[model samples]
Structures are given as structure tokens and as C-alpha cells.
Target: MSRRIIACEVFKPYLDKLLEESGVEAVDYLEIRQHDHPELLARSIQSIIDETKDVDEILLFYGLCGNAILPLVSKGIPIKVLRVHDCAAALMGSNAAYRKRFEGNPHKRYHCLSYGERDDEYFARTSPEYRKISEEYGEDNADYVFSMLYDKFSTPVTYIKLGLDGEESQIRRKEEGYYSVIEGDLGLLRRMLKGDDDHVCVTLHPHEKFVGIYDYEEILTTVNRNHDREKTREE
Candidate 1:
């Protein structure tokens, strides 16, 4: 069977053009908009739900709304929310609530597609012609390619360890393997810690291997130890 799908968009006409060009036989489109501020994405989704009541599935390309939007969209529609984005790419996904506004067509099946994944599949389909990128820039260049593709979807990772060598060393440090007067990347670790504590303080020596296994507990302990050590020397 051909892919029967009713697609939703804040702008309906735009969606129509896309369908014709792409040759998607089973797609329905809806237009959503708000004059006040585009940031109020919830309103757009509300429109979809009101306009569309009997959908089998919805395909949305918007924010990854995390856990926030699911409750509202599911309240009115029984169909599954189909979210799509590019492969680890710039276009991640939209909140599900925005999806609720669309009218569901029982004839359509639900699925999500991201250009990012399709792009990968496209290159893979191209084969040796696609392999030219790897031949020219090397495999490591794939990160740059992914980075470009995921630009819409990517965000900065919060808990980053600056200089850890390997996993074995990390597990050892967690197991108290650095038992005695040990040197480690204390200063860098301290910078990484979030909470302010009075109990622990840790010193980092430049020569020591940095361990990344330290969770919130280890992070706090390191901070507290270093805090006291500073005071002891002052006294």
C-alpha cells in the first residue's frame, strides 16, 4: 500500500507544495499560526487538535518538548504522535501539543521522517559516489557532517569532563583506587562542580590523570575537601 498519511503544518499551503514535489501520495495537511508571538508553540498545536479530530497518526518537526507536551496532545486524540527529524541533525522535533490541532484521517498511517536520517540513507544509497566525501576528508570528518546536519536539533551538553583518558581509570577512581596522596585534575573538576559545600575540598595536580566518573556526590566531596584545605593553610 502507498504511504497514507495526514501531515500537519503551521502553514498549509507550504505543506501542499512539499507533498507535490516529494510525490507523497497519502498526506493531508493543516495550517496553524498565531499573530502575537511564534514562540507560543502551544497555540499552534491547539489549532491542529481543533481542526483535526480523527487522525491515526501525526508527523511533527518542531521542538523535542522533552516530557512537557505529551499530556495535552494525547488528551484529545487516540492516535500516536509521530515525531521526525534529521539524523542527529539541525531539525530535531516540535512539541506534541502542536500536533493535536490536526484532523486525523483514518485512511492515513502515522510515521515521522527527518531529513537528517533520509540524508544518511541517500548517501548510503549513492554508494561509491557518496564514498567520495570519506575519501576526501577521511571518516573523522563525519562528525563535522553530522554537526552540520544536526544544527537544528543539537544543544550544548551540560556536564562535560575536560580531560579524562579512559573508562578503566574512571572506574578505579570511583572505587577509591586513588586511595592516598593522589594527584588529579582537581582544579578542572572544581570548575565543573555546581553546588557550594563546606565539607570537602580536592586539589588537582597538573600531572595527574583526570577521571570523569565523579557524579554529584564526588563533585561535592571534592569541593568540600578543597574548601577546608584552603582554610587550614590560612590558619
Candidate 2:
């Protein structure tokens, strides 16, 4: 079957390596900044799905991502998506693994190669909504504003190393704010690429709409469009 991958750009390095080894070249990497607006991110992905032609299946390398993928509909082609809360959980291998590390620490921040390398740039681009506050109040005040907004005081930062080159040193050089490192597993991603529709993935057949679930064990599921519409109306 002809398959294509539509993934977040943050997974580019790992996916690049995997795709090269597997000789799978049909992939579209979307900007990580789109994540700042869940609705816009969903629309962007839907546009890509609408534009793709002759592909029997699309592998989506994403988590529910604040429900960004919740509104996505399969336009004839089937879509397979990872069943994790976000990229951090996907990198950790599963939601259970992620919860083991961060179940009670809601204020903790997650850092991976992509996030660590572009820390400043990521914040600057993803938080354009705070630009006016920064401009009007100056940077120091902006920092305070952000801290208040996110409750970031003494927030622990966990960096997950997927054995990528230069990742260790980069973690060491990162400004120390309760920072630590842990090994990450890419097994789930590898399975996804290999078309394993196991527990870590949710597959949506043609015309099915993706939906987010509150339970971490289940993560996500799909429903028929008409059923989803009626459910929404009932709510």
C-alpha cells in the first residue's frame, strides 16, 4: 500500500534517520509552532489530508496535543496516530511511562533534543500572544508575567535522551533549573512506522473522526462523523 507520513517537525531528526533506514520517503513535516493554536493546527493537518492524493494510508506522528488531532477526519484514506498525551509521552514510549515520571508533578517541564536546542526560539515563536506584554512591560517584567502565567517557579525540567548525537553535552550546558536527564525509548515510534496497530496506536478508517479521551490508558479513539455530530449536539 502507498503510505505517507504527516508528522510534527520536532520528530524530524529521529524520523529522518528511521525513514532513511527504511527507505520511506513520502513524508510531510509540519511546523512545531502550529501547536500554539490547537484549532489552527487541526485545520492545517486537515488541509494536508485533503491535498494528499493516491495514498492509501497516512501515518500521523503526533499525540492528541491539546486535542489538535481530535477534529481530524479521514478523507477516504486511513490514518494511524500515536495514542499519547503529547510528544513528551510519545518519546517516553507510552502514557504509563510518562505518568510514572510526572504523575504528580504537574509543574515539571519536559525537554528533548528538539526542545533543548531551540529553547529560546521555541518560546519566542510559540508565545506570540505574550508579545504585547513583553513589548509594553520590558523583558524582566515579561519574565515575571510568564512565570505567573505558567507558575514556573522552581519548575523541574526533565530531558529525555534518545541516544541522539551531542544530546548529553547539550543537556549539561542547559541553564541549570532543576534539570535532569533520563533515557528515552523510540520503540513505540518504530512500531508505528512498521504499521503495528497495537495499544500505543489508534487507527481511523475512512470517514472516521478522531476523538480524545480523558483516560490515559485509552488515550484516543475514533467515531463515525454522523455519530460524532449527534454526540456533540447532545452535549
Clashes of each: 36, 0
lDDT, candidate 2, 1-235, per-residue tens: 7888999987887888788888858678898878879999999998998888898888899889989998888878888899898999888887889989877887777878887765645354246646767788887787777766444634557888898886878876756764677888988888888896668789888767777786878888888878957978999
Q: Taking the tens digit of each residue's C-alpha lDDT, what string does model 1 give over 53-158?
A: 4544333322223322222233333322222121111111121211231125222111112221233343342445346766788766754564444333322211
Off by over 4 Å in 2: 124-133, 149-153, 176-178, 228-235
Q: Identify the leading candidate in terms of lDDT.
A: 2
TM-score of 1: 0.24
Kindly report which residue stretches of model 1 are placed more than 4 angstroms away from their true locations once superposed: 1-39, 65-71, 79-235
lDDT of model number 1: 0.30
lDDT of 2 at 182: 80
Clashes by residue pair, model 2 = none
